[model samples]
Target: MEKFKKRWEITQDWQLLFPLIGIIALAYTSYKISNAVISKFGVIAKVLLAVALFFILLRFTLFLFKKLENKWILDQKWEMIRVFIVFAITGSSSMFVGRPVIKLLGITKENLNVFIYWILFIIIGLVFYQILLVFFGFLFGQFRFFWEFEKKMLKRFGLGKFVN
Candidate 1:
């Protein structure tokens, strides 16, 4: 417990609950996903794969928190959870908006080659993702962070010229 607190720089004991719950939730999700993929495997293999995936997901979550820590406005460790939630919403929103637009445009996997269909899907998804990032960020009370993030992303995509 002390080590976990020190490692994450968490100040209060109560603050620990969110991360702990997050880890357990991630582990359970990993277990469920691994089970679906490895249902034919032996119990030992399934347990091993689930454990491995849990650790990988945990590491990924930590890495993502570290990377985005500076970008988020709140300095508290628990805020990482909120940031993650906001990102999750933004991502889902992007997909929600992208799929309908693609269908409306008659851009279906059945209509185009698999490669082209995927390329178009990704392109459209990316555009919706950028737009929804800011929209959801605003809804989540992190408008400035996402607005800046959007600008940076657009700049990288060579659309900076239109930003000003």
Candidate 2:
């Protein structure tokens, strides 16, 4: 535990929560991904797949950490887990928020063309995602990283004039 804390630069007990949450979230995601394919497999197979995916996902996350470490400008390596959690929450919340807004706007798959409804849904979700990303970033103490990310995203969408 001491080694783990030292590795993550965790000086306080409360600061350890983020990494724990990150691991729990990752394990759940791995299990879910495995469950998706479990209909064709037996129980033992599902367990195996989940374990395999957990390691694979862990590896991918570490790869991302390695790649983004230099680019993200963080004071500590552990902050990446918090940033990732905020992003995950923001993305999931955006879809949930957009769904109700779409209904309130009297737009639905039943009324609108399916393709058009999907396109509008994606657009609305993306807009809400932008807002929630910054909100969650501030909440997670990584506002600077996400603010820069948001600026770059806007520039990519040709909304640079507004940001500037």
Candidate 3:
């Protein structure tokens, strides 16, 4: 535990939650991807594939950590993990929440052109993504980081005036 904390630069107990959540989220994502790729396979196959993907993803994430370490402004190295987790949750959740919203608005492929429905879906997802990014960042104790991120994003979208 000491080594783990030292490696992550974590001094507080609550900061430990980020690593634990990162592992669980990564494992769950790995399993979901494995199942999608091998729907007809048995449990053993899925488990093995998930394990392979987990390690691959872990390696890729580490690579990203090294690459992003200097690019992003952060006080602690452990905060990078928290920022990533917030991004992961916000991205997945935006789509999940957008589905119900699209349905409620009676938006469907059968009702509209396939292309239009998809376009609307993407737009709605983006809106939710923006909102959820800040929301989850606050929940994860990175509100300032994500708020600044959101402002930049809005600026890129030509909504900078609103942010100001």
Candidate 4:
């Protein structure tokens, strides 16, 4: 327990609960998604696919957490988990925004060339992602951290001159 706190840079025992809650939430969501798949496929196939997906999501989360840990200026290690949560929310929100925009523009995989559709989709998604990153960050109580991150991202894309 002590080592865990130290590694995560958590100061109090109660702070551990955040990560615990995050883990439980992730597990529950994975279970629900797996069950949804099971309804469409056979038991054996769905079970294997679900298990594979669960691991993949877990690994991806960990990878993102580590990447954020390196890039963001976090006060504690456990905050990486929060950052991960905000990032996931922003990404999903971006996709949600992008989908409607694409539909509104009458751009569909069936109508447009597949390559063109995807390029437009990704471009729209990227724009929404940048906007949502700060909105969600503020909602998550990590505005400063995400604001800095957004600046860095924009700079990397050659848009830094417009930011400040």
Candidate 5:
């Protein structure tokens, strides 16, 4: 029991962790809701729509901090946000790219129309996915900038060694 308590104190930050947990829960709920909508509307059509919305949300959240004033920035905070943004961008784009390819291969077992639709889906998804890649690349570059900025700030404030 003592060991468990010690481990929990070492790793847990409930205030921070809860918000992340909430966001994850919300995202999962949104996905489930969107998936249901997609299945009802047309599997491919709903999926494409959800993908578009997800990318838009990801892009907006990723860049939202850029609009903040200089005084409002925090090194660790910005790093976390940037990391999440990159993860979202990378994950969404990977899904967008991978899903259609897999589906295309699967469709080849069924019918030519399925293959054609898969090709169309891939082509369309690739267009948006490639755009997302560019955006993600831009964010990755920005992360480097922020990382350097954080280091410089820490150094300037004489808290350099305190930062990790």
Candidate 6:
């Protein structure tokens, strides 16, 4: 039992442990939900579903980055880099899902307004990230909630003294 507890503690200390698990969980859950909805309604439904999923996933990824920055795991400049990474992930995922969407809509990529659409998507994603920061700022009154939350957690673990 002691050894097991020790292992758990070590696992938790690994920087990206919980987050990587969360990313996998989110991807799997999104996949299942998307497919279930698509089957129930058909390809026409998947179009709206895909767009909604993309927005929600993008929002959540932004939220995660905010939390990470709050924890000081990433600095302000690094936060910008993280945003680009999230954009890349969402952009690529959209392209993969979108090819089929375009086909279902009886539209060809070459015939579509690709630049305008992607620019709009990128703008919205950026706006969402900004909203996340504003929301977190309002919620915590400037200090990051996760930082304070972690502090409290450390106190619970009798690690508070060491933390400060």
Q: What is the C-alpha lDDT of each candidate?
A: 0.81, 0.92, 0.95, 0.85, 0.56, 0.52
By lDDT: ranked, best first:
3, 2, 4, 1, 5, 6
What candidate 2 gets wrong by more than 4 Å, as runs, is 40-43
Clashes of each: 0, 0, 0, 0, 0, 0
Q: What is the lDDT of residue 55 in candidate 3?
A: 100
Candidate 5 ranges with C-alpha deviation above 4 Å: 1-81, 86-112, 136-164
Tens digit of per-residue lDDT, candidate 5, span 1-164? 44633522323444345235535643664566678766667767766766666666656754654555253443444344444555466557766676767575564535568678667666666545544554674655554544555567558857789757
Residue-wise C-alpha lDDT for candidate 3, range 1-164, written one tens digit per residue: 99999988999999898899999989999999999999999999999999999999999999999999999899999999999999998989999999999999999999999999999999999999999999999998899999999999999999999986
Task: Quote each prediction's TM-score.
Answer: 0.72, 0.91, 0.95, 0.75, 0.28, 0.29
> Per-residue CA lDDT of candidate 6, range 46-141, in tens?
656766785698688777656665554433323333333443444445555555554675664466688865665554544344334334434423
**How do the residues 55-160 of candidate 4 rate in per-residue lDDT, one tens digit apiece?**
8888888887777677767888888887777887888899999999999999999998999999999999999999999999898789998899999999999999
lDDT of 6 at 60: 82
Q: Judged by TM-score relative to the true structure, which candidate is superior, 3 or 5? A: 3
Error of 5 at 128 (Å): 2.9
As a whole number from 0 to 100, the lDDT of residue 150 in candidate 2 is 94
Q: Which is the better candidate, 3 or 6, if ranked by lDDT? A: 3
Any runs in candidate 3 off by more than 4 Å, and if so which?
none
User: Cα RMSDs of all predictions?
Assistant: 3.6, 1.6, 1.1, 3.4, 15.9, 15.9
- Whole-structure CA lDDT of model 6: 0.52
Backbone clash pairs for candidate 6 read none
Which ten residues in a row are the worst by lDDT in model 2? 37-46
> Which tens-of-lDDT digit does each residue in 8-70 have in candidate 2?
788889999999999999999888889898868887888889999999999999899889888
